[model samples]
Target: MYMALIELKDVSKLYGFGDATSVALEEVNLAIEQGECVAVMGPSGSGKSTLMNIIGLLDRPTHGDYYLSGKHVSRLGANQRARTRRDRIGFIFQSFNLLPRLTALENVALPLLYKGRSPAKRTRKAWDMLERVGLGDRVFYYPRQLSGGQTQSVAIARALVNDPQLIIADEPTGSLDSNSSRLVMELLSEIHKTGNTVVFVTHNPELTRYATRVVYMQDGAIKYDEQTKLGEVGRYARQVMYAVPETTEEDDLAGVSAIMPVLDKRGVAADKKTKLPRRKSTSHKKRKVLKK
Candidate 1:
């Protein structure tokens, strides 16, 4: 039997202590095979970020185990975890965390700097990675000079500079508009086509088209998981997108009232019971005076 590229067995993460303790992940379990593109979706405060952190080896579970490439990794020490993360995992974020002053090439080369690669080798590799992401022409542009989509492409190049086995993107297109978002997702899909194991977090139902599997989380647990064909929305997500009641002219006008609260039908009935005197019509008097 083939083992999973990533696996979590009864994993949990907690913050604080004693009465103040908060559960970010509650005995959560997940698995991803090599070359599988996965999308994780959940509402705010639903443990999606925490789960990604643990899977990416940025955090350890408070209880249970984690396996990467079939190796137990949940209990690795700080330095060991850092090394493993740098060697095997790449991260892309919503903010496109690039140094503002550095050119795109320099930013993409930053990761190779930590690995002690020679300057010439790093430059060559970074240039090639930028070309792979279709930003070869923009390699010398500063982060401030690039559009949102270009900036994120630079971030993706940086992430892949190390040739990591797994890619973890947390809201990679959150900061982009619709066109830019599509650009980023298409770039990611191209990477997936080249046999990378990719896991991304997104709240957009439409983005699920790029994923082979979709995981839905709620209340710190995986509520649903489904395999979906590429280029189509997942079944559960499709249900959610179509669940909203379609609006019509009648539906839009239903709750509106032409009368003020004092002149409302119910208020008029109460006023009649009290026998209150109604004000004479000033508009009628004005019309009579105008005729004279």
Candidate 2:
């Protein structure tokens, strides 16, 4: 098995010329392993979107070789690039990108249609993808009839309809509320779990919790990132603002004991984190109510 499913060798993407010329990507080099789930974080005009386009095979670099599964693809002709993308890459976007007039199944089937698949085959594959995303019952529902979460699910189905080995997602949860965002984010994680390489782009700090490794960008260049586990973020959530005290088995037990009433008999929180306990106000005793 090759180490890198995708590789960018000193790639540079430039736009304009003369005084107006700008280098969006400047000699960027990186490798993405198979089945890895990563997030690219950057501000607008940081070139993260441009990098995503290049990685998705929707754009080309001005200089250097871009390889997919070890095959250099920068010089590939338009037809060749299209074929490669269709065969091995999938894309998810913030907008969901579903054809509003079409049913969820039809929207998912659109990619297969581009592949010239038979009607029966495309329908079967589309329904299967929909079911995989837990949207079987909504197969006939149109995008307008579905919730934000459901719409993104249909978009995911479309991306996977062709069984692409690589999935590129850009701000996938951008438009959703917390509930919808969690559902869509978890769904994407499951997709990565099933052995497809996933490259996600976002600026949300909390979203980085799900990334195996994060890529931070500024001025079209990578800054700093670190490997992480979202599962570990629970007890460490406050660590971002304050240092984490040394934790021991006893300390954990004590913390759990303090939180016991919050958790029901099943060990699940009954209140679902509506409010947190806070330190007592030091000024409480000094204050007296004035009754006029």
Candidate 3:
């Protein structure tokens, strides 16, 4: 029987202890098959990052089972987990996470260094990956020299250098402008097309068009999950994008105006009670003094 590429059962993550405990994930269960493009959507503090961390093996769940490639991994030792993470998963971060001192080629080659690849082989593979991501011309450029979009492309190249089966991106375009965001998402979309599993966390509803499925999370639980067609926004996400009323300057001013009376009733009245009396005209006295 076949199994999911990634699976989580009864997963829960908690920080602190006793009365101070804060829950980040609450019995969250999820499964992703191979070659699926999944988008995890939620507000901040909604456990999206926690879930991604667990899936990426950067963090273990406080309570639950995790299976990667149909193998139970929840209880793996730290070293084993790290080894597995390096061999099976690729991560793209919003901050790019590239070494500032290294050129684009060197940064992309860094991951292969961990696997003990020879310098010559690492250089060849890294250069090929960079060329694949349309950054061939920038192989020797430092990260600071690249634009936001180009920097992210280099990051993408680094992620793909390992040829991992799963890609986990945490707000990959969070720090990018609209055009750069689109470019990054397109690169991710291309990766998805090549039969790699992709799971990304995003707040923008419009980006759901690239996802074959959308998972909406809230309060550390999966509130909604749906399979969506490519090139269209998920139904739930569409409702969220369009259902909210827009606010205008006039509306904001009206709201402020409505609250002004209450503010005046409390603050203005107190200020008036503490107000100082105005001084009588000193100009007249000065004029008389000048005449004298």
Candidate 4:
């Protein structure tokens, strides 16, 4: 049986209390399988960032359960959670989050230091990841010396340097231009293809084209969770849609027939037709709460 890479049940997050209380996430439930690229979409204050933080082990939910790779982690102590984050989760942020004073290679090597790797080994591994991300030439360049795209590439290399299985990116392309955004998204797609689970939050629906599944959120709850029909047929269709055709009618028909079987077998239509079920609150006693 297939297991979820990340799972959340009845998860909720609240801040302050009484009149000052704010509900950032309410009873949100979600599961993401390994090797899937999931894009979380929502407006500002819709709890997308909060959900990412909880998944990344930076924060704990106020209520309910969270399981990462089938291990219950919602209630783990701070130090334990920190260790889990270091070992199992990788993070990418909108601002790149690279240290201003550190070179691209040094920033990528920082995580390995916590794993007790020797300085030489850490530097070597960091160099490999930077090279993988097309930053080999900029390894010694500080963040200020690199362009915006190069900075983000370094951040991506740093995130993957630790070889974590789960990657969480929050608005990774928000600060980039169209060309830079395309580069970042393509890099993320490459990462997902390697069987690592990727979950990112984005406000742009156009970016969802690169994701296998899209989860839409509203009012701190999931409103829609649907798969993108980007199989062989869909990809071919997209290519044909963009390219001016030069083939004859018979050749086009033959090409269509060749891909029809894959489309039928994959049931692409059914996958795109998912709906979120209405959820009812089980408890009305909101005045009091127990601390986790």
RMSD of each: 17.1, 11.8, 17.4, 15.0
lDDT of 2 by residue, 1-292 (tens): 5648899998899999999999899888888888788888655677788889999999999998898888989989999999999989999999988898999999999988999999999999999999999998999999999999899989999999998999999989878776777777788888888888888885444555566777766667775555655432222222211121223456543433322321323223212221222222323122111100
**Per-residue lDDT tens digits of candidate 4, residues 161-276?**
88889999999988886667767877887899898989988654446666788776777888667786432112233222222133456754353342233334433343233221
Collision count of model 3? 0
Candidate 2's clash total is: 0
Worst 10 residues of 3 by lDDT: 271-280
Model 2 regions more than 4 Å off: 1-3, 230-292
List the pairs of residues colliding in candidate 1. none
CA displacement after TM-score superposition, residue 187 of candidate 4 (Å): 0.8
Report the C-alpha lDDT of model 1 over 152-175, residue by residue, as the tens digit. Answer: 999999999999989999989888
Better of 2 and 3 by TM-score: 3
Candidate 2 local Cα displacement, residue 261, angstroms: 40
Model 2, residue 173: what's the lDDT?
A: 81
Would you list the clashing residue pairs of candidate 4?
A: none
Candidate 3: tens digits of C-alpha lDDT, residues 269-289: 232232211232324235233
Each model's lDDT comes to 0.81, 0.74, 0.82, 0.77
Which of the predicted structures, 1 or 4, would earn the higher lDDT when compared with the native?
A: 1
